[model samples]
Target: MKKSKRAITPEDLTKIEVLSEPQFTKDGTSYTFVSTKINENNEYEANIHLQQLHEEKSTPWTYGKYNNSNLSFSPDGRQVVFQSNRSGTPQLWIMHTNGGEARQLTTFKHGASNPHWSPDGKYIIFTASLHEDDDVASQKELSKEEKQQLTEAKSQEPLVVSTLKYKSDAEGFHDDKKTQLVSYSLEGNTFTQLTKGDYHHLFQDISPNGKQILFTANLSDNADYELTNDLYLLDLHSNEIKKLNERSGYHQRAVFSPSGEKIACLGHEYDYAGATLTELYIFDLQSGERLCISNEWDLQLGDYIIGDMRLGASENGPVWSKDGEKIFFIATDRGSTGLYQVDLESNLEILHKNDSHVFGFSYHKETDKFIIGISSPTNPGDFYLFERGSELRQLTTTNKEFLQEVFIATPEELEVTTEDDWKIQGWLLKPYGFEEGKKYPFVLEIHGGPHMSYGQSFFHEMQLLAAKGYVVLYTNPRGSHGYGQEFVNACRSDYGGKDYEDLMAAVDYALDNYSFIDEDRLGVTGGSYGGFMTNWIVGHTNRFKAAVTQRSISNWLSFYGVSDIGYFFTKWELGHNLMEDPKKLWDFSPLKYAENIETPLLILHGEKDFRCPIEQGEQLFITLKHLRKEVEFVRFPDANHELSRSGNPKLRIARLEHICRWFEKYL
Candidate 1:
């Protein structure tokens, strides 16, 4: 008899290693990627791993406690370059492909990251922070006393606010430091500042001929007031820069074609604000013409779905085919992200179709094969090798041991019909060791992003709830991606309207169909927009016995001025600024309905969360307490909005414990 798997525990999260940043060598015979694992000290440890196509196992290329990422293979396939924080600040490092002592490259004072190799492998381009007063033209290092003065100046307490975006969630208070493109030459072991500006410049790609570099920056005089990124091309020889596109939109992650004739990128206009689907665009470097090739395709490009687990990859690329005739990327459709390909003739095709999420992928033209990182509810992300006419083969099994020891609940797909005749897609996770006749408590989990989707990706929080004997139900409501753009935009001007109904309809559909669920013992929770919905749901109805809101928004009126993106996000998401329509903002705020909330609620927030700001949660908690309502507030120190996902591991585990305890006490 086979042994049954054990239920998953919160600590299991620490044991699972996340793999990402897969890069294929020029020969296409081997590949490299990054693996990040949490240590006993509750810190993330990252390293690079290499795997040959014919080999059965992958070997670690770099071993240490320091963080390392952004791996890129050299054109000659003899060496690899990546960014590391071993020296207390991120810097570029290069190592032989065959594995040997690594050599540190650049040692910039402000730090350097996102290393991109020139096509010839003679030079490396990266982004480094530069102060406004720093002279880039001089190319001189700061004196010891000057460095001390700069440090003391930064250590001052009071902040002199000048720009509208003076604070950021990832980077706390804004400084005079602006990220600019810089280059390092391997032959001379010298550094040169490529671009000079007060605004931040993000390096995108290097042209095939190595004569130009592609990057994006908000060069507008009112950059603090505008949230726009326009693509620019920099000539390497003359240092001349020119704008590529004249349209008003946010363009990012652009890459040069293999032939260096065209550039492909992911972007969108502010037609629907934050809820607008990201479209793929192709720009002709010669004619300076740009066209949205995916305009006809309604699905959103790239992945926006967020989960508690530490996801390794960001949105996959717009990689051009070796012939430069086709561009490949990922698209979120109906809750799953799939690989897609588009040709110059506007021919769109689904290269890889599945119900699971493809977090990252790389295609090597020499072999005409693809290496993909995929994850599902039952499987944590792993690398797989795929070819056009062959079966997919799992290349790396980083989480195989964890899967063998834990019983990950596989969610059952559900289709819910709302009163507005919209079909809402969702999933349900039955409690571990479920009994056919027993009535198990249920929890309705909502995802944030109102723009993101709740898909087939592995979610640690939902799995933990299932392991603790709760039927967890989560859905992609109307405002979510994967559906058509029309559906995603449905909840923009109308918050807590059809979107709330879509969530409620999901719960109703589950209770009516699932026989093992205990409708009376119900719980609800979500974060960010989902947290906002949880607050809204409790105020609107007492159906839920318990609720937990994390990093949520309670008052749009206050959120407009406090949040990092508040000023414009309020106008973008709610379609109203405080000055334009304060009444509408007040009407949509969940704190306004605090008096009606009867369900026991737990408010969890991170102190340093500038995105939603801890004030949002504090306001809601105070209002409910003054009303003598059932509420509890839990605050985490030195943590940001990403506490649940990338915060301190100990705090993340504690958050899970808090949620489980809150639900257990009330339900």
Candidate 2:
């Protein structure tokens, strides 16, 4: 096994807090999760914990450290199965729910993940990928000359791959190819292949009766439309796999109703022009008929307005209650996603709403309680249990120890009107230890996915900036997701046009309203599309004092050819392909206007980022240096686009710290 490394600096340790995968036992007496525990020696260790509440006292049922998590309890609650990489590759591991005798379930050379217990508790289903030997053999199948070429290709490290259409920030490590489903039996010690071939199947959920499995996959004939993944039902008895949803749309988050009579899932039907919108649908198990339960107006998932039914940031799939009469889910169409319980019989009524992001949830029918996993811009991830509709009670405080030791700023929501008369949403984070009438530097942080929303989730960089005495501003501009499809598609072909205006409008609004914000000391930073926007912003305006772009797109023309998903994303997102119009790609590239940038810019990238590619960073870095502009580059090895979320925890922390260092020095 590759030895785990520790963060060299104390600042690095403090910045990265490891807490994820909160799961509950059947009786609701205990919970299991994975988190990093920092020892007194300052070394970080990954751990899995089984915490139980007894006599009003929380006791550690079982706690051990070795980089484990993604826990799921068995139906009987006798065992807890999870995935871990301690065996060199991520594989399935199981231990008694009470935390005894941990056993490795799968010894396959290929990695296995996302373990789900069967209802009868006899088997476990998980996703698996190709083995290293298979990878090598596949490459070896080519002719001698071709093999030599591939070997040479493997040996030669990635250069500034300028020939491609789209380049990811760090680029070229492992080609994330196919992932499939498999089932294993505990008694027989035998594994069965449930799903086969090149397509990927993820987020698997078993039917209540253990008769079938529901998952999302893109196995359609039109492989080009892989982005439009649909739900599929796999019959364990007949080994038959059938597509569930009919529309040439996207379907995901399939959950079986308690009675096994129906299935609730989020359906996204896509028309031409490429708009991704989600709607809640309940499919009758026997009749194959689906009922659309949400407002027809591009229903955003997550949290909703209680009475009037408005959408805010919903893209969350529906969750069935213990009795299955009520479907609990989070939708953002109304406000930031709070917990909402929709009565399936009443056509989905909103139950609870909050101005925070609620991602995971569980309904306990026995106690008539609901457990929700929520996060905000200030708090990362924590559990909240709701009983009888009284005030919600917080269960865990994973980051409380660190948060108490540090000064953190709270963000204020600002409703600003755009020139288009649209009221865009934004939040301003004042510096910690903030004083009135004191001017503070500010950083405009943009989110990627343009389709992805920045919810009330704990952001290390945001807090770090606030700790560094900089007011941070982040907003969901027009092109951002969580609003309806109309809002997301608004920036379709006009990438840097209106979306840029919305972001700028947010900054303008914050500056006008927040007296403590220093306009001259402003800086900007973002990743992916946000990175593209940051590149666009600095070139268009010298208003910001400095900027940092992480895993950004400098040149769209190159991105279309180099990155793995470049061919599709460029065409779908930009509405133009290199084959259609090369000049159009160049016109939108940030590198096109690199000559105009005067901002002291810092560029950070991963060495193995396939989404944005390292070339994007090198291109921008070289251009800035050539222009005699201030620039610094930090490259993290073996990291990807997801580095901010779940990459090497310490490196993730370093990335946040480095960005703060740059903004503090330049802004």
Which pairs in model 1 have colliding backbones?
A: none
Alpha-carbon shift of residue 562 in model 1 (angstroms): 0.1
Candidate 1 residue lDDT tens string, 317-342: 89888898888888888989888989
- Stretches > 4 Å off in candidate 1: 1-3, 135-156
Candidate closest to the true structure, highest TM-score: 1
Model 2 accuracy (lDDT, Cα): 0.72
Give Cα distance to truth, residue 605, candidate 2, Å.
Answer: 1.9
User: All candidates: CA RMSD in angstroms?
Assistant: 2.3, 7.0
lDDT of all the models against the reference? 0.88, 0.72
